[model samples]
Target chain A: MRTGTGAGMPQRGAVGAEERIRAAAVRLWSERGFHGVGIRELAEEAGLSSATLYHYMGTKEDLLADVMSRGLRRLVLAAERVTQQRAGAGPRMNALVQLHVLTHALRPRETRVVDGELRALSGDRRGGVMSLRDEYERYWRATIDEGRASGAFRVEAPGMARLALLEMCTGVARWYDPGGPMALSEVALGHAQLASRVLGAEELELVDEVDWCRGLVGEIWSGPGGG
Target chain B: MRTGTGAGMPQRGAVGAEERIRAAAVRLWSERGFHGVGIRELAEEAGLSSATLYHYMGTKEDLLADVMSRGLRRLVLAAERVTQQRAGAGPRMNALVQLHVLTHALRPRETRVVDGELRALSGDRRGGVMSLRDEYERYWRATIDEGRASGAFRVEAPGMARLALLEMCTGVARWYDPGGPMALSEVALGHAQLASRVLGAEELELVDEVDWCRGLVGEIWSGPGGG
Candidate 1:
C-alpha cells in the first residue's frame, strides 16, 4: 500500500519522494494533531529539507486542508460508487457500510485526519469540507429514511437513527486494528449486522450468521495480521 | 447563580475571582481547544492580569485540569445523588438522564472541555479524571444491564445500549439553545423518551416524561429563577 508513486511520478516499487512527504505529513498530523505539528519537524521527519517540502505541498495549513479534502473526496467517491452499484435501500445501505469499512481499513490515517482536523480548516475551506461531510451524511440519512418509509426499517426518527448508525461506523476508526482479529470484510459484516438490527432488519439467515461467525473466529485466531 | 463572593472581597454582587476564572477558562477552551489558548489571553478574557490569573489558578495546564476535574466531579456527584434519590433501574435510569441532561445544559462549556480535552491530560491527573469518567459511565452501564436483566430493557448488548443512551444525552450540549422553540423541559422529555425507548422502557406517563424533562426545562425556564 505504501509502494505507490506520487501523482506525476512514474510507477516504482518505492513511493515517489512527493508521496513519501505526504505520507509522512499524514502520520505526524495524526499523532500530534493539526496545530501541534510544525513544518520544519515534518520536513526533517520525512528526510527532506524545508524547501523541498514546500515543493511537494505548500504551507502547513494547505497541507492540512489538502489531506482532509483529499480523504473526504475519496470517501464521497466511494460512497457514490456504492450508491450506484447497489439497487434497493437495504443493499445500498449494506454497500455503504462495506465502502466505509473498506475505506477505513485501507486508509485509517486519512480517515482520522479528516475527522480530527476539520476545525483547523478555516472559512471557505472548512465550509467546503463540511458541506462534503453533510453530503456523505445525507447518504446514510436517505437510506435510513427510505428504508423506514418502505417498511423495511422500523426505527423512529430517521435523523437520530442516521446519527446512531454513523457514529457506530465512525467509531470503528477509533478502535479498529486491521492487523488484529477480524478481517476487514468480517468487521464490516458484523457492523452491517449491528446497523441492520438498528435499522430493524428482521432476520439473519444461517449463511449470514456463519459468515459473521467465521469472520470473528478468523479475527480472534489470527491475533493481529499485517496491517 | 453568579453572585458568589469570597470572604475579604469588597464587591458583594460580583462573582468570586476563582469562579470567574473557571468560567472564562471553560469558554476559551471550548472555543479554542486545550492547546490553542494561552494563559495570558485567558486572563485578559476574564478581565484579569496574568499575575492575578496565577493567583487564582497556578498554570495553564493546572487550569485545564481543574476545569475538567471540577466538571467531571460534578457529573459524578450528580449521578451519585440521582442514584441515591431514585430506586429501581427504571427510576434510576430516568435520574441518570436528568442528571446528564441538566449537567450538559447548565454547563455546556465545561462538558465540552471535559469531553474534548481528556486526551491532553497526562499521568496521575489524567488517570484520576478518567477513572471518575469511567465510574460515571459505569453508573449508566449498570442501569442498562440491570434493566435488561430484569426484562425492563430489551437491548442485546448492554455496553452498546449504554453508549447509545449516553451519546443521545451528551448530544444535547451540541445543539441546545435557551431560546429554542421547545422549552428545555420539552427537549429533555423528548430525549428521555428517546433514551427510555432505546433502553426498552415501555411506559410513557407524563410524570416520568416530566421527570425526564426536568433538567432541560430547569436549565432554560429557571434561568433567572435559579442557576
Candidate 2:
C-alpha cells in the first residue's frame, strides 16, 4: 500500500492552532520528506514560533506519526463504510477502489507523507502506523477473499491482486490533477473499471458510483470528523 | 509512469570506480532520498574521498541523472527486446509485466530511486530523464494498442489502464522480499496473470515465461552494458 490511506490532525484542545500546524506539516513533509525538513522550517511553514510548535506538535517524529495515523484513520473509516454497505463483494470492491482513488487524488500531499515516511519513525511509532495500515488493508483483503469464495472473481493470486489494485489506485495521487482534463469522478470510475477487470469481475459489472465515493472523501478529508 | 524505468550512471571514464560510486548513490539516495543525503556523505558511503567523488561521479545531480538514465536505459532495452519477439500483443504484454516485476523485485532500491526522486532532478536533467522514460513506456502503450486493435483486450480506458498496470507491476519493489515464502518466479507469473486479466485478456493465453524474463533481467542489470 504505497498510499496507505492516512495522514494526521490535531488531537484535542487548541484545535484550530493544532490543525494549522498539522496542515503545514503535511505539505512540507510531503514536499521535502520527513528527514529533509527542519523543525524551525516546519514552524516557519506553519507560522508558529519554534517553541510554540514543540508545544503544539511535540517532536517532528511525533508530528509525522500523527499526520500518517490521521490520514490512515480516514481511509480505514471509509473502507469500513464501504464494506458494511448492503452491496456484495463486487460493488463493495468497486466502492473501495473508488474511495481510495478519490482520497489520493484530492489529498495527494497527506497521502505522500503517509506513504513515503515510514522509515523516519522509531519502534512503537512505526508499529502503531503499521497496525492502522493493517486494519485498512484488512478491509481490502476480506473483500477480495469474499469475492473469491463466491466465485465472483478469477484472480489467480489474491494477495498479489490486492496489492496490485492498491498500488494502481494510489498511483492517482502521483499522476492525477484537479486542473487536468480528467474529471475527479471520471478518474474514480475509470479506476473502478480497471479494478473490476483486474479482479476478473468485469463480467459482473462494477457497482460504479463515484458520486457516493466522492461524498465519502469529502466527508473524511474535509468533514468535521476528518481533520 | 512514476517508475518509468530509469535512474543514473557515470557518463565519462572511471569505469569500475564510477560503477561502484553510482551503486552506492542508488543505495543511499533510495534509502535516505536525494535531499536527505549530502555530497560529503555520498563520498564517504562510496568509499571515495570527496575530491575523488567529483572526479568519478561529477556533481550529485549529475550523478542522479546518470543513475536514472542508466536504469531507464536498461528497462528500455528489456522492453525493446520483449516487443521485438514474434509473439503477439498478449505475450508481449505478459513478458513486459513479468520483466517489470522481476526487475523491481530484484532491484528494489534502484527502482525506488527511479520511482520516488523525480522531483530531485531539475530543468534539462529532468527532461532527459522524462524523455528516456517516455521512450520506455512507448513499448507498453504500443503493446496495449496492438491488443485492442486485434480484439484481444477489452480495456475501456487505455491510458488509465497503462498507468494502472505499470504502477501495479512497479509495486513488486515495495512489498516483495527475497526471503519471503513466495518464489520469485511465482511473483512474476502471478503479476503477468493479473496484468493479463486486468487488460481484459484472461481468456487469452498470456505468454507467461518468467524464466525468460529472469534471464533478460540478469543480462540487462549485470550485463556488460548495464554496469
Candidate 3:
C-alpha cells in the first residue's frame, strides 16, 4: 500500500470541502442530470452555502466539466497502466474488463455522471471531455485490434465488439447493488468472460488480473482525487 | 405489408397532432432529460401552444410516463411476437437481439427517454413503467434460463448474462448512425452474433431471424403508438 502524494491527492485523513462539492455534484447529477440539478441544491447536499460552493466551483457547467474530466482522467490512467503491465492481448483485455467493471460497480455515481452527462457540456468543454473519453476508449480499441491481429480474437468487426463490450461492462453501474447476491468480484469475472467470448478469445483465468485491477482502482480512486 | 388496424394504431399517412406532441416530448426529453425540459419548450418543438400541449398531456410527469410506457410497450409487444414466432432458444434470443437493436437504432430518442428518465416519474407512474420494463426483461430472462437449462448456453450467472446482453443490445440507440458504414441490418446481425457468442452457443446463422425481426419492429412500432 503506497501513499498517494499526487498534487491533488487529499491528505491521509482530511477530505476537503471541494471534494465534498464534487461528491455532491456527482451524486445529484447522476440521480437527476446536469441540467436537472441546481447549484442551491448542490450546495445543500454538500452542506455548504451557495456562496461557498461558488467560491470553490465556478459554474455548474464548470463543475460538471471538472467532474467529467477528473473521472475520465482516472480511467485513462488506469487503462494505460493496465496496458503497460500486461503485454499479451488476452491479459491486457481481461485486466481492462476487470478495471472497468470495478470502477463502474464501486463508483457507480461518478461513472454514471461521466457516462450520462456528456451531452450537458458545450463547445470547448465538451471537446476536452470527449478527448479524454476518446483517449480512454482508444485503449480498448488498440487492445482489441492487437488481439485480432494476433489471431487471438475472432470478431468480424473489432470496433463493434469494443463498443458492445464497453457498454456491457458500463451497464453494471446502472443495476449493480452492493447488497446484491453476487459479490463484486464475481460480477467483474463474469464480464471478463463475456468480453472474451465476444472477442472469440480463449477464456483464460482472470482472477489474478481482477485482483490486481482492484488494487489499481483503489490507488487511482483514492485520496484527494478520489470521488 | 399488412395494415396496422389494431386499436391505438395510427391511420395510414396521417400524423395526428397528439402524435406530434408525443414525438416532440420524446425528442426534447431525450436530449435534455425529463426534468430539464419545460412545457413551453416542448410546445414550441411540437408547434403547439402551451394550452394545446396541456390538452395533449396532463402534466410533465404524465408526458414522461406516457413516453416511457409507450416505448416499453412496443418493446414488450415485439418481444412477445418474437417468442411466439421462434420456439428454439437460440433463434428466440437472436431475434430478440435484432428486434431490440433495430428498435434502439430506429427510435433512439424515445428509447433513450425510457431508459434514462424512470427516476423522473413518481408513485404509480414509475411503478407502471417499471412493470412494463420488467415484463419486457422477463422474455430475455426466460430465454436465457431455457438456454442454460438445456445446455444451449453456458454461464455461471444467467441473470448477469441476461443483463449484460440486454445492455449490449440496448446500447445501439446510443451510437448507431444511419449514414455510418454498416447498414442497419448489419448492425442487427452483428449484435445477434455477439449475443450468441456471449451465451457460448454455436453461432447459428441469424440472417433470417434478423430479417424477420426487422419486420417485427416495423409492425410493433408503426401506427398511432409509434414514437
Q: Tell me each candidate's RMSD, in Å, in order.
A: 6.5, 6.2, 5.0
Error of 2 at A112 (Å): 1.1
TM-score of each: 0.74, 0.90, 0.87
Off by over 4 Å in 1: A1-21, A38-56, A94-109, A172-194, A200-227, B1-15, B47-55, B98-102, B171-227
> Which of the two candidates, 2 or 3, achieves a greater TM-score against the reference?
2
| Residue A36 error, candidate 1, Å | 3.3
Better of 1 and 2 by TM-score: 2
Please say which candidate is ahead in lDDT: 1 or 2: 2
Candidate 2 per-residue C-alpha lDDT over B1-227 given as tens digits, one digit per residue, 9 for 90 to 100: 02212346343346556766887888888887887788998888877898999986789999999999889999999999988874799888988888999999988888898888888899999999999999999999999999999999878788888988898888888888899888888888888888887788878775667888888888889853263
Model 3: residues >4 Å from true position, as ranges?
A1-17, A43-56, B1-18, B43-56, B208-211
Q: Which 10-residue window in model 1 chain A sums to the lowest lDDT?
A: A218-227
Q: Interface RMSD values for the candidates, listed in order?
A: 3.8, 1.1, 0.8
lDDT of each: 0.67, 0.84, 0.85
CAPRI accuracy category, model 1: incorrect
TM-score order of candidates, top first? 2, 3, 1
> Can you rank all candidates by DockQ, best first?
3, 2, 1
Candidate 3 yields a Cα-based lDDT of 0.85
Candidate 1 lDDT for residue A9: 60
